[model samples]
Target: MRTVRNVHARVIEAPADRVGALLDRIASDDDPLFPAPVWPPMRFDRPLGVGAEGGHGPVRYRVTACTPGRSVRFDFAPPADGHHRLDVEPLGPGRCRLTHTLQERQGPGQALLWSLFVRPVHDTVVEELLDNAEHAATGRTAAPPTTRPPLVRLLHRLGQERPVAVPVPDGARLARTAFDRTDFSDAWRVPLDPGMPRDPRAWRDVLPFPVMASEGDELLLGQDARHLDFRASLLVGERDVTLSTVVRTHNRLGRLYFGAVRHVHPFMTRLVLRRTRRRLALAAPAAGSRHRRREAALG
Candidate 1:
């Protein structure tokens, strides 16, 4: 096994207490420091404190130590051996330094994976986190924003969330009754993140179909063609969004056309849904802004 250590530090033109307050909110709902939506938001099963259990995406860790606004350390879950930590230091009354360090013990395979894939993504995340820290504390980043390297961008795209096939939901009444006799029917779904739009109308533009009907949580869109008549449903639920398609054939020509199209339909549907989900997520308001809106509503 080999030991791997990585460190990132940024000097913020804010008091240590001010910057450290941002650190304390790391995995909270209103986190203003950890860059998210583009990257997965950091999450914990409970509140952000020692013993909290959760991690962003596939990375799993448990908080083993915490110093409130000053420092926190996470120990990687089983199958991975390492700990990563963040700390804040006072430089002066009006300035502070924030640092993140990651150390892990890796076998040959793990080390290779880290060097090629994990390192690039990890470094990018750390730098972006620091940039957010600077912004939240001083209203601007001291340095230019971190640009993701080509490999990192490619990896991120390839690793994006994928849609899963599901039975047509009963809640999609418009899609269910769109056609008198259905020849083909299918549905695909993807989870919605915290800040993602929840209204079905907001997702209507994902398909080129004309709006057929809409009710409650589902928007129905489709076109009647010479070969086949089809209906597409976009259902936005509390935690996920479902895209469903239904088709009806008029005759042999319709049957033949749909028979050929159905083969590629599932693949195309999943691809489109995944891409649109990511696009919407990236376009959502930042966590801090959303949190402020919620506070205003409550107030």
Candidate 2:
């Protein structure tokens, strides 16, 4: 059997004991390991020690040995013949490091699955976990990867589309209201809430370019920079909204930029949509009034 390995590590600002306490909390709750939609599959047949039964992700395994605030290892099954471990190493006083490794033996079929579907998702999620750990330790969010892979860059050059479905109350002015709350300029940099806008045209001053289109319940807004021709839209429905972004990479630079974000594109779309939904319902009346004023002006 060929042993395959995957590992992720991060330097934490917290002390060894504090980091270990965070790990213990994660083990007990599994919240950090598995966020919403990605459920943890640990079968705690016994306590946390050697021979205890549980599995991380899809690899079924039993505990090999566990040293509190230090290391915890698990042994896998036949197709996944190997082990996984999470270690907390003391870098020095007031500083520590965390490493999580998954080692398993698998055949051709398993390898294909891992390469195509599992690896990408796992990479993104693991990074998220590390970010969360850092946040828990220091109350600061970790910076994520700034670029995508080679293939993803090529795909970006050709073009790519991402759509997120977000549920919200349906109203006549929903589309405009949705746009009223959008600001993605610095979203890639830091965390900020950009909700429905009071004036769709207001974005013209904030963004580098002019307004693209602001229709009834559908707004197309973005800038066509030298790197890429980007257009983001809010397609409002009766009870839900589909936030979609289309990128037409202009040249190699555009493709490279797209490639950099391709991995995180899906999650970022969902996140923005989720954020938009929170303010959509609350701003319905304000949006309706604005829509009526526009109609009156046109008449």
Candidate 3:
């Protein structure tokens, strides 16, 4: 096994207290530090304090210590031997230094993965966090923004959430009753991230067909063709969005056409949903702007 220590630090123009306060809100609903939507959001089971038991994406860790506005430390779970921490130090009356340090003991396999993949992503995230801290504390970042490499971007895309097959929702009434005799039906769903739009109307562009009907939180779209009549429903639920498809075959010609299409339908639907989710996530307001909006409202 080999031991690895990685460190990233930046100086922010804002006062130490201001930068530290921004750190204190990490993983909160209004977090203005952690880069998210582009990367996985840092999260904990409860709040940002000792014993909070959650980690971003597949990482599993628990907060071991915290000093409110100054520092926080997290220890990794089993199979991983390490701790990562963030600290804020007062540089002067109107300046502060923020640092993130991660140290881990890795086996050969783990080390290989880290050197090839994890390290690049980790470095990017830490830099982005520092950038966010600078922006939230002073309304702008001092340095040029970090740019993701092609490999990192590819890895990020590969790690994107994929849709899962699910039964058509009962709430999708228009889709459920689209055809007098349903020849085929299927549904797939993907989760909605915190800042994603929840209105089904916002997802109307998921399909090329014109909107046929809408109710509650569902929008139906499709066309009646010579071969088959089909309808697609986009339902935005409390925590997820479901895409459902229903088809009615008029005769042997419809059945023949659909038989060939069904094989690729699953792959196409999943790809479309994943792409749409990522697009919308990237389009959401940045965390710093959102935090400022909330503060403005509160004031």
- Top-scoring candidate (TM-score): 3
User: RMSDs, each prediction?
Assistant: 2.7, 16.3, 2.1
Model 2 ranges off by over 4 Å:
30-43, 145-299
* CA lDDT of each prediction against the hidden true structure: 0.87, 0.54, 0.88
C-alpha lDDT (0 to 100) for residue 201 of candidate 1: 85
User: Residue by residue across 31-108, what tens digits does model 2's lDDT show?
Assistant: 333221222224456667778886654557788888886888878766566787889999999988888887777788
* Candidate 1 segments exceeding 4 Å error: 282-299
**By TM-score, is 1 or 2 better?**
1
Reference-based TM-score, model 2: 0.46
What is the clash tally of candidate 2?
8
Q: Positional deviation of 65 in candidate 2, in angstroms?
A: 1.2
Each model's number of backbone clashes? Answer: 0, 8, 0
Question: In candidate 3, which residue pairs clash?
Answer: none
Model 1 steric clash pairs:
none
CA deviation > 4 Å runs, candidate 3: 297-299
Of models 1 and 3, which has the larger TM-score? 3
By the lDDT metric, which is better: model 2 or model 3?
A: 3
